[model samples]
Target chain A: MSDLSDERIREEAKKALREKGLKCVIGWSAEGTPTFASTEEEIDRLSFNRSCVNNLVPYLTYEIRSQRGKTRDGKDKVVVPVGVVVRGCDSKALLLLLNEKILARNEVFIIGVPCSGVVDPRAGGALFRKCVKCAMRNPVVFDVLASETVQEDEKDYSEVEAIERMSQEERWALWEEILGDCIRCHACKRSCPVCYCDECLLDPTDVAIKPDTTAEEKAHRPLWVERSVNVPENLVYHLARLPHLVGRCVDCGECERVCPRRLPLRLLTTKLEKDVKEIFDYEAAKEEGQKPLIAMSCMEDENGFIM
Target chain B: MSKSILRKDKVAEALSALGKQSVVYAPVKNKRGIVEYRELGKSASAAEIELDGKPDTPPKAIIFPQTEVLLTYRKDKDGKFEVTPARPDEREKVIFGVRPCDAIGIAVMDKVFCGGKFTDPYYKARREKVTIFSIACDGPMDSYCFCPSTGGSPAATEGSDVMMYDVGDSYYVEGVTEKGKKALEALKGQLGKPSPEQEGRKEAIVEKAKSGEGFTRKISAESIAKLDNSFDSKYWDDVARRCLSCGACTYYCPTCHCFDINDEKGGERVRTWDSCQFGIFTMHTSGHNPRAVRAQKLRNRYYHKFKYSKDNIGRYLCVGCGRCIALCPASLDITKAISEVK
Candidate 1:
C-alpha cells in the first residue's frame, strides 16, 4: 500500500481550494468516486486508496474540449483554476492531453499521487489488468507527492499474446461474441480521455453527446447515425476505438472495468499496444510538450495507410 | 391459489420442462462472471440458474429491447412508398429468478409505457404474455439495495405473478395472481406438495423481511423530502462535476423508459432507449435545447426520479435496486444524490 494517507490527500486538496483560489479541487471521494471539493469541509472528504478506480483526467477536458473559449462558470470573469488529483496511469493521460494542447499548463494545478496500482473491488480485490502490467508506480508528473513511490512491476503481455496466437477464425469468433453484447451506451467513449471530439466522425448526424453547438448549429445540423445498434455497428464502434487509443491509452482499463456487459476490452487495447511497440517503436510520452505519436510521420512506418 | 415445493435439484427439471413449451428466461452467469438473464435451452438448465443475487442489468430489455424496429417503409419504381408496421410479438414468456426490486421496476415501467395517457403497443404486447417469477431476498442482498425506501419490500409482488422462497433444500412457492396460478399448472408434474415445515420457514422469512431489518444502506424519508426544495441548490453543480454523462446509469436502470424514435435512410422507423443525460435527448429541431449543460442534464435525472415521478405517478421512480450504483463507471450513488441534495 502507498504510504500516503487520506489525511494528506485532504490537506493537499484544502491547499488547492483555499490557497490556490480555485473554485474546486477534483479528487476521489470517500467512496472512491470522481468528486470535487470547493470548501474545506468538502476537502475533508478527499481520499486515496487502491479502490480509487476512476481515472480523473477525463473530467478536466469536459469544459475545455467543447464550448471553446468559454468556461462553464459563467459568473466568474477570469478563467477558473481547478486542482486535480491524478494517479500514475492517470498522469500519463494528463501528459498526452497536455502534449496535444487539449489542456494548458497555466489553467490548473496538479496534485499527483504515486499509486501502487488500483485494485478491482469487483474482481475480488484483485489488482487491475493495467496495474498487473504497470511499468511506473510513480506519477509521471505531479505538483505534490501524496504518497511514497513503490516498486513497479514488469510489463506482462500474456493476455494479448493469447489472443494473438489464436487462429484468425477463432479470433473473429471471440471478438464477435464480446462485441455482440454491446448496448451502445458509449460509456467507454464518454469516459475516455482521448475521445474528446464533440461530433463522432462515425456518424456526424448532428447528434453531439455534449451540447457543444450553438442554437443555429443545433437546428441546422443534420440529424442521424448512419449505422444502427446491431452487430456491425457495435464492432465498428469498439474496433475503431482500439486504433484511436493505440499510443494514447495508458491501459487504465476503465473501459473494460466499466462495461456493464463485462466485455474483455483489455484484449483490444493490449494487442494494439504490443503492435504499436513493434511497428512504431513507441509508447505514449511521459512528459508534456513531446510531439504526440499520431502527429509524427516517418518513412519507416510499418503501415502504409498514410502516404 | 396453488402452492408447491420444488426441490433444489428438481429446479432444472421443472425449468427444462417449461422450456419445452413457452420461452424460459432465467439468470445465467456468463464466462465473464457477470450474471444476466439468458434463455433456457438445450445446454441451459437448473444447474446453470444463478440465483445468488441480482444481475447487474435489469431484464427491462427482455420486454423493451434496446433497439426495436417499429415499422419499415420503401419506395417502389412507380415513385410510390409502402410502409409495413412491425408485428408485436405473440410468444408466451416466463421470467424466473427476478429480484423483488426489479419486479417493482417492471411495474413502474408498466405505469410509464402501458398506463399513461397513451399505451405503447410494443410494450403492452410483450408485457401481457410475460409471467414474472420473483425470488425473495430475505435481507439486503448487497450494500446497494434499498427497496424499502422506494416503498417496495424484499419480496414485492405487485408486478410478479409468482413468488418463490428458498427454504433449505426446496423452494416454497406461492401464486400471487390468477396468471401466476395458471402458469404453475404447467409445472404440476414437477412440483410436490409443500410440507407444513416448509410453509412455516417461508412464512418466517417473509415476515422478517416485512419488518425491514439488517439493511446497511437505506434512503431516509427526510433526505427524500429535502429533494423538493433543492432544484436551484449549488450542490447539484458540485456533484455533477464528476459525472461523465455516459448514460450508463439510465441504460442500466430498470425503470428509466425514455425512448427516441428515428427514421432510417431506408424509411424504417426505430425506437431505442434514450436518456435525459444525453444532450440530444432534449434537442429541438430548431437547434434549441433546454437541458443543454452538464449540470442541467444530470439534475433532470434526479428530479425525474424523485419529484416529478412522485407527483405524476404517486411513487418515486427509483426502486432502489441499485443497479445504477453498482454499474456506474463513476461512483454517483443515486441514494446519496437524492438524500443529500443541496
Candidate 2:
C-alpha cells in the first residue's frame, strides 16, 4: 500500500491532468475525505491512507456527467476523462456502473491505488468488515496502476453467517432495533456509488410531477413509503433499497461508514451479495460486460422469487 | 442559589433516585463505544453514563425529537374530516451530564421555536417539563470544541437548571434557576454542604472556563463579519465539491431545528427534521429548485447558521460543539467554512 507515496500519486495526477485534459481529479484529502483537485496545489493535497474509506468511484458520475468533465473548454467536442483515485473496492463499483452503460470506458481516467483495506470508523485499529473479506487488493480495471498489487484475503462470511444463525425472533428484534435508529436521512442511499437515480422511488415525495404530468399519473402515484421516521416506515425505506441493489451493489461499505447512528448497513447489502452469488452463479463487475442477475432471467427461473 | 456536594460514588444512586420520578437522559456509551445522550433503562444503566468527554451527539432529541406528530386527522361516520392536535410528551425529564455547548444550543433552539413570531406548541410543552443538568467543562472537551466563539462558555449556564462542576471526588453543584433549584430537592438526601476547598475548586473551574483556552478550532469576529460579503463567493463550491448532500451535519446539529410538515400514512401531520444539505429541501412543487446544486445547499446551510439566524434571532445558530465536524462523512468543518469565507 505504501509503494505509491502521496507525492507519487500527485505526480501521476498532474501528468494525467495535462495529458488527459482532465477538469478535476477526485481523490482523498489529507484528512481522508473525498475532495476535488484541479490545480497542482490541490493535487498536492491528495493523499491516501487506511482511513481513505470513501469509494470515490461514485463521484466519477457525479463530478462528471456523460460529457466526462462538468467544465469544458469553448466548443471542445472531445470528452476529457475526469481523473479519479480508486481503490480495489471502488474499481469494482466503477466497472458495474460501466456495465450498466451509465458511463463509458473513456469517461474516466482511473488512477488505481493498490490497497489492503480501510480501517473501521468505529475502531481506530480494526479493519472494516468488508476489508477483512476483501478478495481483490488490486483494481479490477484501471488506466494507470499506482502501485504493485498487495496481498488479498480470502472471503469470510462469518459476520453475515453469525446473523443468519440468529433465531427468527432474534433476527427480527435485531432489525427492529437497527431500523428504529434510522433518522431517514438517506445517507446510505446518497453515499452508494450505484444508487444514482434521476427520480428515486424511495424519495418520500412519491411523485416528481412535471408541468405536463397527466392527472391520471398524479392520481395513480403510489405512496409506497410514508414520511414518518418510525420503525415501520424506516423498514420500507431500507427494504426499497434492497431489491434495487440485486446485482448492482459492489459492497464498498460506504453506507455503514457514513451512518451517524452507526447502523450495520453493510450486512444487508453483503448478505444480498452472498445470496445472489450462491443462487445465480454471478458476481457484479467480475468482467467488463456482465449482465445483471435480474436482467438475465430465463423461463425456467424460480417463480418463488416473486414471493 | 444553593450550593452542595455529592461524591461521585453516590452519583448512580442519585440519578437512579431521580429516574424514579423522571426519565433521566444521560450520555451513555452505546454498543459502538460512542457516547450519546440516551434514556437510562435496562440496556443502558445509570452507572454506565460517560461524563468525561464530549458526547458524540448533542442532546437535542431529548427536547426536540427528530420526528414528532403535529396533528392527527381522521374521517368520522359522516365523512367530515376531524383534526386533533397531537398530544405532547408531558413526562418530567432530567437530562444529566449535558455539556455547556449543548445547553447553549438548546437556548438557541428556544429562540427559534418559542421566542419568535410563532410559538410552537409542541416545543413549548416538551421544553417546559424537561430540566437540564449541565456539566461545566474545566476546559475544551476535545480539539473540536469552540463554544466561546459562538456566545457560549464551558461554564455557560443560560439553559441549565443546575450547573455542575467537577471538584475531585465530588461535584460542586450550583442552582441556576428556580426550576433547577426545585429539581435539586430530589437529591437532598445525597447533598452535603460545600466546604471552602470545594468552593475554591469550583471558582477555579469557572475562572478557567471563562478564560476559554485550548480551543484550537474557532472562528474570529473578523471571520463572522467577513461572512457578510461572502454569500456568493466561489469558495463555497470549492469546499462543497465533494459533499455527498446528506443530512449528517444538519441532523447532528443541536441548533438546527428546521423541519418539514407532511401528512403521513396514518393521516397524521408530522414534523420531521429536514436538512438544508439535501438537494430537494428547497425544491418547489412546480419542479423548480432554488438551491439545486450541492454547492448552493452547502452555502444555504452556512448562511442559515451564521447570517439568517443572526438577522432574525439576533445570534448565530451554531453552538460550535463540532458534532458536524465529527459526524460529517465529508469532514465539513463549519468553523473553517465560516472563517475561510472570502
Q: Which numbered prediction scores highest in TM-score against the true structure?
A: 2
In the range B1-342, model 2's lDDT, one tens digit per residue, is 279998899899889888888999999887766689888975688879998889998899888888898889999999999999888898999999999989889999999889978998899999999999999998888878898888888899988889999999999888899999988998988889899999999999999888987788889988988878888889988888778888889888889898888787768888888788776577665656778878898888888888888899999898889888877777778898888888
Off by over 4 Å in 2: A66-79, A205-221, A303-307, B41-43
The residue-level lDDT of candidate 1 at A211 comes to 39
- lDDT per model, in order? 0.80, 0.84
* Residue A39 CA displacement from its true place in model 2, Å: 2.2
What's the true lDDT of residue A246 in model 1? 76
Candidate 1 per-residue lDDT over residues B1-342, each given as its tens digit: 388998888888888777776799998888788788887884366688798787777889899988899999998999998989999888889999999988988999999888779998899999998999988988889888888888988877878999999898988888988998988888888789889999999998889789888777788888888877888898888778778877789988989998888776668898888878877778775557787777898889988988899999888889988888888888888888877776
Return the TM-score for each candidate structure: 0.93, 0.95
Residue B315 error, candidate 2, Å: 1.2
Fraction of native contacts under 8 Å reproduced by each candidate: 0.60, 0.54
